[model samples]
Target: MPDEVIDCRGQRCPLPVIAAARRMPEVPVGTVVRVLADDPAAAVDIPAWCRMRGQEFLGSVDGPDGPAYDVRRTH
Candidate 1:
């Protein structure tokens, strides 16, 4: 299935994290989510959030717009 993508550019710390959290429930378990962010702190924050939430942090990459992360939720 096609994963959902959340573009959180220009948003700050908690907002980016919050946006991801909001959509995460809709993603279902085992599916991936691509979070595109450019807040600089997202690199650290996103991973940490994923860890705390028991999600899979598949890693991140530099996309054309900014940084993108591959996250998978596990129930």
Candidate 2:
């Protein structure tokens, strides 16, 4: 489970990552951001975004709607 959840279902590439980034600063280190995305590309892009941004890609969680990207704030 994550500290905060960013629902990006139906959203494409950059939106999911962008939304997550917006809320990343709100949490402390070691906390995770759960990004719910229906876009299939998000499976790879979200983790890539986290890596490019210096965050930790904690991995994925499956939901009824879609998969969630568990990203931990490292910076």
Candidate 3:
């Protein structure tokens, strides 16, 4: 399970990624944040953000609302 869950299903593109970034600081390192995004670009955007930001992209799965990305805070 994720330490936190941010619902961005209705949001578009960078918004999902941005929302996830904004919520990251609220959780401790090593914890995972599940980002729920409906935007198809999120599948690529989230992983790219993780690679650039040094966060661990634990990958994603089909969520009730959409695809939920499992992102672990590394820094």
Candidate 4:
């Protein structure tokens, strides 16, 4: 499966994480979730959440608005 994009701009802490968690299952293993978030905390929170969830933190990129993360679920 190909990676999917989730727009999390304007969303707060747990919202972005929760939104990603909800969409993650739709994506197959080895695929990634490209989360676009404007939350500054996401720069740290997302990676930590991925780690805690046993997902692969593929890293992030600077988008026009904010940082976007690439997350691959292992399980």
Candidate 5:
């Protein structure tokens, strides 16, 4: 399970990514942050954000409302 779960459902493209970015810094390194987003852009953006931010993208899974993207804090 993720150490943190950010719900971005009903939000649009950049909002989901923005929320993840905002929350990621609060978690400890090596902890997993799960982003629950319904926006289709999240599928692409989250992974891309991980790459750009130098974090570890742990892929995604289906959630109750949408897909949940997992990212581990590497720094």
Candidate 6:
């Protein structure tokens, strides 16, 4: 389970990534933050965001609405 779950289901491209960026800093390092996004762009953007931000992308899983992207805060 993730330490935090950010719901970006109805949001578009940059919003999901933006929400993650805004909220990730509040979580403790080594904890997981899950972003629930329905936008197709999330599939690509999430992992890229993780790479660019130096966080660990733990991959994603199917959710009721969309995919749940798991990110481990490394810093």
Tens digits of per-residue lDDT for model 5, 1-75: 899888889999999999989888888899999999988999999999999999999999996757999999998
lDDT of 4: 0.85
Candidate closer to the true structure by lDDT (higher is better), 3 or 6? 6
lDDT of 2 by residue, 1-75 (tens): 788888898888888888988888888988988999988889988888887899999889887857888999998
lDDT of each: 0.86, 0.87, 0.91, 0.85, 0.92, 0.92
Model 1 lDDT tens row, 1-75: 228788898888888889989988887798888888888888999999999999888999896868887789886
Relative to the unseen true structure, what is the C-alpha lDDT of residue 2 in candidate 3, on a scale of 0 to 100?
86
Reference-based TM-score, model 4: 0.89
**What's the TM-score of every candidate structure?**
0.91, 0.89, 0.94, 0.89, 0.94, 0.94
Which residue pairs in model 6 clash with each other? none
What is candidate 4's lDDT per residue for 1-75, written digit by digit as tens? 226788999999988888888988877788888889988888888999998999888889986857898898788
Backbone clash numbers for all candidates listed: 0, 0, 0, 0, 0, 0
lDDT of 6 by residue, 1-75 (tens): 888788898999999999999988888899898999999999999999999989999999996857889999999
Candidate 1: regions farther than 4 A off = none
**Judged by lDDT against the true structure, how good is candidate 3?**
0.91
**Could you tell me which 10 consecutive residues in candidate 6 have the lowest summed lDDT?**
59-68
| Superior by TM-score: candidate 2 or candidate 5 | 5
Error at 22, model 5, angstroms: 0.7
